[model samples]
Target chain A: MKKIIQFIVLAFVLLPGVARAQEAAGSINDMWSFPVVYAYDEEVTWFFDLSTTTFAAESDVYLWIWSPSEPDAGNWENSSEFAKLTYEGDMIWSFTLTPTEYFNMTPEDIAASAGFWFRLKDLTGSLQSEVHSMAYTDYSSFAGSGELWRSYPSSPLIDEGVSILFNANLAEGFEDATSIHFHSGLNFWDIAVEYQSWIPEVVEKTQLKNMGGGIYKMDLIPQEYYEAPDGYVMENIAFLFVKDDWAGTTADQVLYAGEFIPPPPPVFTFFPQQISKKDFLGIIRTNNEPGINTLIYTVTAGTVEVTGEITGGVSEIKGFVNLVSALQNVDVTEIHVLVKDNTDRTISDTTIPLKQLD
Target chain B: MRSKIIYGLAIMGLIAVGCNDPDDGSYVDPVTIYEKMDGDWGLMSLNMVDEYAKANAIEPSEQNMGAYFNYEDFKIRFSVDDNMEPTTYEVMGDVPPLFPANGYWKLSSAFQQPNGEAVKIYLYSDAQKTQMTDELKLVAVPGSGEQMELQLVRKSGGIAFVSYSFKLNAVN
Candidate 1:
């Protein structure tokens, strides 16, 4: 009887602690669904950035969604295997689902309700992330817009997903095309994923999803879709939409990759516009690169030579040398100055004429 | 009538006492620039200026050189005789010789020039003060703050081009 009483006491003490631990660790940092735009019945993969949460990397994560509908209701403590998310490396997790199938609702029902809202959790609901919602992109307006093609994020990065919508009604020969395939390449055909209709896998992989009513969509993550080699820099994607195994095709098209603006160049200049042998010479450089913090300099006037170094960070490096004492009574019209960085890269080597003092 | 005469004499005596000059005490000798300048001075800042660039309105015409070549530890001392007259001057730190390190020194004027002309410190290489080495303009006289500024100008063809200004503070 005493053992039973002690067991009850321990259960009371530890149960609440376990309940508290089941609460959300943190909110998702970011959430996005591939195909940026999709129909309610179309398959899409929703990605979550869990880096900001307490969820361990590459851990088993499951979805517990409620609004639109909760197909896995009454099972929060033991999420179904179908709701399990695949762990993408780098603390990112993804779940691929068709809204209509996952919610067990009609397209009209899913669209009429509030968007996808859910918290990510581990099996048995012991640990979870804060509630988050996946963003939806509606592309229905492009049907009547009379545009041939449009992409969901006008510029796309190589590793991110991009959705390209096509208006077949506007194309000359796409009306009777049983299917459409993407024959694309990176950097103007430097690397290509050819649409070989003979290969069943290649044909299916390059096929576009027909959205009915002369509208179609092609979704891809450039890096994976092209199977580019390591360190492959994608400048632009060049391609055309082919119809029914070369029965017809659209004009050649190119989508330029996002622009990367490099940092401004470094600038070197002498402090004083004019100098004399009896004045201190100032060396200054601004907008330097990282780790280029020091400048070593050598100045020669007649038989006298002076050398020293100045140190600073990425913004600027500046110093002054005492020429008055070093070149006292020395006869010279100009002094040769050589400056190099800490890495021994020559920054400047030139002879500056000394201004005759009056 | 005798009472009136006594009152009148008292009034005149009181007037004479009030008219007498107030005692201002004896006169003391005025302080000279030599007395204020004769001491050990530590360098506070040393600036090199491009006078030609400044004349032409160019940017970055001046730079501070106090941190270079051991100038942070630089010191100068001026000695005077018991009469408070200028005698010898010496640079104390192991720094580059911007001027004659040790020399007999004298002021261009015993007192500040009333005409506003800058007084000069003339350095001589000999005790007899026959050979002149360098001259530095006393740009700022030592004031109540115990600080002074000296400028050495380099010139050619009677026009100044570059100059060095040394600002110093009394050590003790």
Candidate 2:
């Protein structure tokens, strides 16, 4: 019995060592974090693209990080269920954790450490991926940038997390405020997340995290925070920093969404190098603005008047008007053309001289 | 003997002249524009040009509309009688009716115009080809590659405004 007990103890100690010795299937193709930047105390998800690795799709993946402090230190051979990553499909896995809470270390310690260093492994700790480190965005320099407001990513997408840092010291009427809140909207208030002081949830959701010395940060995924409808195109976020239930508010601020490139201006024109009264006149407009699909045209020649509409999408709207029939017997020297888009915006109003056909 | 040698040289010269004759013993009838444009033609591309934009030197004076409005399946068949006279023209596909879909058609000239004037294809709604419906210009005659370009121009007063250029390939 004594020998058996000693053998069992030896097996328990050697089993982990053997499991740790198992080779990783392959290295992960890539890894990144949403928000791209986050504070140590904030919750962030580390995504691992395991497509290049031999890891099975949607397989159970667990974190085995060490630097910035390891939370699951003794749970390598049998990782805790909490350490298991959530499979995000396409051979990708994500582990969402607040660095401070996961490591049981202060934000300062996490910052001072060598960042997020880890390898991903299976439950048995046999199949693993190569070691990787998640880099931290050091926003410590923002304190001296002297800007009133700065977004972690200068331009932010609607669905991703964005950290908006505000320097209350730069704004007036924000001094001695108990709390700061974000009152914002997308596309110049086309959609809004109003800071309703009466609603407890709204009050809590809009409150900003005071970073001390009049520096505050508001971290939010714009889509989730605003509950924007499907297919909502976010242009620029119009916002203001409100202090303590609108006791005092800073001036209006705007942060343009990332990749919200404005479409090119619409171009309208008549077709053919030269025209005669006995030809079909073409009307065309390309690079039409959104909601400006149809172009209505009115042509005036002598005493005769003709009107028609050319319809298309954002790319172009083109159609031919039967001028061969419209002006068959009409004698004229020039024709006046007026073109307007579906939005009632006039695109062109001009006169074209006739090229007398011999 | 000298007389005989001169006669032999004259016979050889005649043979050489006969061999060097420029004309081959073959005759090919001239292919008219109607015959080249006959049969089915599939749309290779369709472009809309803005004449006002071009005249003013504006950007994006033309747009390729080949991919729009089921134009990829767009086909036009210009039929001719045994005498090679244009009989009836019909456009295939459920695309926009840029012109009359089917009609009796006749070309302004059976051959390409040589006076720098565009040859027009007159479309008529009546069987007798008297009631005119639309007209399209034969901008490009079918070449060795079985490709042709037809343009429909829109005009007001006497000035050309917009045009649609249809590049087509002969379908086997």
Candidate 3:
């Protein structure tokens, strides 16, 4: 009779017509609730909606935004550039920009759509830009150099920040009626981006006896390529995507995907788990778990046990280095370790150099 | 094509007239100012040296410079405006000398104070040096035409050359 009741309940819960009962749990995963709405991965760090990042010599787009809040204010004026920074998103940009002078601001918190108003300049020499609002785009790790097991000497230091760009179209492309939405949950909200523009230089020419008017080319390093300023380390930051005109598209269609790096192995910390003093041997073992490391002790008078393992892997290495007679009566010092890669390549061999600190 | 000169005459003041030194006054030649400034006027004349000298903080020497020189494709000029009148000179045919990035200069004139002291004022453009006021004058030429040496009494001096970029923009 009890089994019959259970079978009936199971069948009812699995029925296609029956609605699945969602559990009213107290906690909801942040990722599950707040999600990335849209993105375009073909660009560097700039994500857009009415911005100066859209500047190009031949491209018919030239307008910049300086609204720190109110993403839709689209206030395109050239005076009183004070209220021009955005601090809603957890980011900052500091540098000198055009027409306007400095790009300096420190952000203390994050909020929805910046409350700043922007003045749009007509660089296209065409129509005026009537931008409604802009959403920030996030870039993940911009694949740089780093080490795992060994702390490499920081001869040259490292740091990080991002450049966000946008396109100011000859005409506003995305609208509320057909508003383009981005899905990158990691997108920038408050931006401090100060885009640059190009000016025309007048050149003169003289007729050379044998040479024609020659061509001159100059090589310059873009500011974006500059190493981060001193004293900071960026975590694998990189380009996320663009949405210069992503509108009315499905969440998947607007998404700009980022490549994820598998998390590094957890570092296993060792505590001298146990030590047994036998007549001729000193046995020692530490908690041998994921990402854990180990070393061997020097029994000035006896033999000792030592082991090393691959982090997050099943490879186990157990061995012993014989302490010779020359070491007899030698104080049994502490153990040290050397971590190796799968190919037996030694990565870290730090001698946790010990001392008798009574 | 019609010749065009981008003459940049930044003269700041009108100078007083009459030479207190009666001997020097009679010898003063009015035609020389206009004659020396002409070379096809702008393509290669006095304006170039004046512009370059003012910008570079060095006056033109007779042989070493203030001579016809080649530049980013075209030719250049040289000149010294009078101290008695506020004059705006004509432009040359080629590209005029840009105020070099080093110092600055402007055109000015001659003067004689109530005291009988003959004072010839020339504009000084170097920010590193004190701005020569209406009281200072162009030092009399050490020598004359062909060997003519133009030096500033307290206002200007030195040989103008392309690489003579001393007294760079102080703000820089």
- Candidate 2 chain A weakest ten by summed lDDT: A272-281
Q: Is candidate 1 or candidate 2 better by DockQ?
A: 1
Instruction: Report, for all candidates in order, the number of backbone clashes.
Output: 5, 13, 56
Candidate 3, position A74, lDDT = 41
The residue ranges of model 1 lying beyond 4 angstroms of the native Cα positions read A1-63, A68-113, A120-130, A148-267, A287-298, A302-314, A322-330, A338-349, A356-358, B1-22, B66-68, B92-96
Overall local distance difference test of candidate 2: 0.84
lDDT of 1 by residue, A221-329 (tens): 9999998765466788898999998898889999888864455799898866667776677899988876789999999988888899999988889888878788887
Ranking by lDDT: 1, 2, 3
In candidate 2 the C-alpha lDDT for residue B73 amounts to 94
Tens-digit per-residue lDDT, A198-292, candidate 3: 21120111000111111111111112333333322222222222122332222221111133333444333321121111111112223333333
lDDT string for model 1 (B41-102, tens) is 99999987878789998766787888887899989999999999888999998887878899
Query: Each predicted complex: what DockQ?
Result: 0.42, 0.16, 0.00
Segments in model 3 whose C-alpha atoms lie over 4 Å from true places: A1-264, A269-272, A276-358, B1-172
lDDT of 2 by residue, A1-358 (tens): 9999999999999997666577667888887786566778888888889999888998898989899888888988899998899999988899898889999999988888888889999897888888888877888888789899999688988887788999998888888899999999999998888899999999999999887888898888888888987557789899999999789998899999989877788766676546666555668788766667888889999899999888898787888766766787789978898988887888889898777653
